[model samples]
Target: MSEDASLPLFPLRTVLVPGAALGLRVFEPRYLDMVRECGRRGTGFGISLILDGEESGTPATPAGVGTAAVIEDFDVGADGILALRVRGTRRFHVRRTRVRDNGLIVADVDWCADDPDVDLQPEHALLGVVLRKILERIDGGDQAFPEPHFDNAAWVGWRLAELLPLEQTDRQLLLQEDDPDERLAMLLRLVDIED
Candidate 1:
């Protein structure tokens, strides 16, 4: 973690993963400051899952695993508010979260890296099949999402694990799994693969 851990936190309803893209509209004063500070320092900001509480109030607990995001785009609203587009660069595990007088949540976190040799489990091949079918069904309607982008079996499982509308706890479980093989296996169960 960088010394910039002192900066504010923005825990969201969703959990983000590394190499993922996220878009956010900044309006509140505290968050605006957080975004500006991150931009000025060229440091990433932590994104945790908001378990409970409104944006203005402090969440009782935020999921420990989160991603550090970089601002891809930002603009000033006519109302003088800021809107930002953020992309996840890497994943981190939260050590602690403290609310500041400025209404900002600061969390101490440590980075996470996937094991180099952990191959995507064999069970995930079935998940690929199911995911393709789901995409076909989804693309038939206007509510379709972008086509799945995957480089390998492991990445495919990860991409689906993030994009699918699984519960927050499920997403956190996937994030905490250090082995790509096990992650892929878990993904299979989520998609309900026959084998």
Candidate 2:
């Protein structure tokens, strides 16, 4: 195990899977510094979903599961805010996080490989179907969610968990599940409608 791996923390409500792209705006001073530091080091930042806090809002422990994101497309706004697109490269688990004097959070993380069975194609197809259905239902109420592209079973599961409007606990459950087939089944049957 590589023990020296460290990642700049950017906690949010979404999950960023490997090969997936995510856009973000940085206005907070701490995060701005984080971006600058990453640029200086030519490294990426860690993206973990905030369990019970908001960006620029509160300090809370982040979930252990997250992906390491590399800044691909970057721009600066007229008002001095930063914007960039980050592509997920790998999965990691947070050992712990510490807040800096500037309000940015940094964490020690370890790289983790997904279970071998997650690479199977059938799992991806099944998860893709369930995800499409979920999105269709959510879109029935509102019209802005973009159609997702899942390239594999692992990606399908990650993207669905990221895009779904479920609570943090549910998303965490999906992340912790090691079996792609079981996760797909749980997701497919996740409904509490009285009908």
Q: Top model by TM-score, which number?
A: 1
Cα TM-score of candidate 2: 0.73
lDDT of 2 by residue, 80-191 (tens): 7788999877778888788887777788887876545445365346567666676667645234345544545655666566666677667667766777666665666663
What lDDT score is found at residue 86 in candidate 1? Answer: 81
TM-scores of the candidates are: 0.80, 0.73
Per-residue accuracy of model 1 over 1-195 as CA lDDT, tens digit each: 543344356888777776566778787778877877887888868787777776565544667777778888888878876778787766777777787777788887776765455444455666666667656666442243345443355566666776788987898788778777777878767767554
Give candidate 1 regions above 4 Å deviation.
1-7, 77-80, 115-117, 131-153
Indicate which candidate wins on lDDT: 2
**Model 2 CA lDDT for position 185:** 58
